[model samples]
Target: MDIFLIILAFVTLLIALVGSIVPALPGVPLAYLSLWLGRWSGYTPFSDTFMWIMAGVTLAVFLADYFLPPLIVKKLGGSKAATWGSILGMILGMIFTPIGMLLGMLLGAFLGEIMYAKRSGYMALKAAMGTFLGFLLGTGLKLLLCFYVLYELVSTWWATGFGGF
Candidate 1:
């Protein structure tokens, strides 16, 4: 039974890692669930306080992922239309994944700037670049948090020896 629970926890963690990139999955929450399951399974390496702290961190990162791109677009002199386009593009881009998402955001911002904001080609390109940078920064932060959760899960599993090797 302990081994089964351990395997389940690991599976959840793996899903969380994938969720970090997939956008549709609630990555941090899933990671937290895995940790909670481990705790329920009698793994004692992570204290309740530690879990609470990680939960808070996860929530913050999740929320930040949504706002960062739009905030960055505005700061870089992008109009409201450009910001909305980036967001819509991001959502639609999820269908094609990675490359599609990247192109979608850049294209969205460029078109928004040209069609709605009436910006020159050079300015539109600059705004698009800013949107791209924001996207990268947000993704990097999420990956870091996901990796940290993965590390914690593995380390606790190793320390507890709950799987019986």
Candidate 2:
């Protein structure tokens, strides 16, 4: 039974960690939950400090990941329409293909710009680029957070004697 609990905790952590980057999955909270389970298991490998830091990273990344894209698009001179359109495009992208979604963001922004400035392909392109950059940065940040949390988990476990290292 104890062994089963440990296994369950580890599996949950794995799923949460994976979810953190795959847009289709809820990442931060899942990662957080995994850590919580580890601590609750009373056999966590990490010191309290490590777990807290990992949680903090998860929270930060979660906030940034959800907000950066729109902010980036807006900063690039995208109107509200462009920003919203890019957001929709990104959501759609998850259902389609990553590349397709990225392209959709650019096209969506372009279309948004066109609604206001038809024939200004150059300006629309700039807006699309902003959306893309934002999306890229957000993803990178999320991935980094995910890795940080995973590392903490492993380190905590290792320090606790899981690997005999």
Candidate 3:
């Protein structure tokens, strides 16, 4: 059962890595959950202090993904409609392809600024840029966190002889 759980933990970590980029999954939280699974499996992969710290960090990162982009948009003079359009685009963008989310977000923000916000073309572009930059920043942060967690998990397992699997 330990071995099975360890394997499941690894699998979840892998999905978290993919989720870092996909935007559909909450990557950082899932990675933290994987670490907890390892702890629950009796591997004791992290210290109590480390676990608490990671929990806080994971929650922060998860919230950042939601708050960062909108903050950036607003700072750059984006309207509420622009934020909603970007979100809608992200959902609709999932239909065509993974990269479509980025593009859809860009388009949606532009349209929102122009139509709803009554912003000029240059201003719309600026707001769209803010949204794009925010998304990229959030994704990058998630990827880094997930990769570090994955390394910790795999390395710990390897050090323990792969838990005798």
> Candidate 2 on 38-120: residue-level lDDT in tens?
66655565567877787777778888988887788778777666776776776776677777777777777778777855537
**Stretches of candidate 3 exceeding 4 Å from the true structure:** none
For 42-113, candidate 3 gives per-residue lDDT tens digits of 764678999998888888888898899899999998888788778788788989987898899999999989
Q: What is the per-residue lDDT of model 1 for residues 1-165, given as tens digits with 9 covering 90 to 100?
A: 666776788898888887777767887788888878777777636787998899899888888888887788888888877876776777788789788888888888888899999999988888898898888887787788878877877788778774567
Compared with the true structure, the alpha-carbon lDDT of candidate 2 equals 0.71
The root-mean-square deviation over C-alpha atoms between each candidate and the true structure, in angstroms, is 1.9, 3.0, 1.3
By TM-score, how accurate is candidate 2?
0.79
Candidate 3 weakest ten by summed lDDT: 37-46
TM-score of candidate 1 against the unseen true structure: 0.87
In model 2, pairs of residues that clash are 45-156, 46-156
**Model 1: how far residue 37 lies from native, Å:** 1.7
Q: Which candidate is the best by lDDT?
A: 3
Best by TM-score: 3
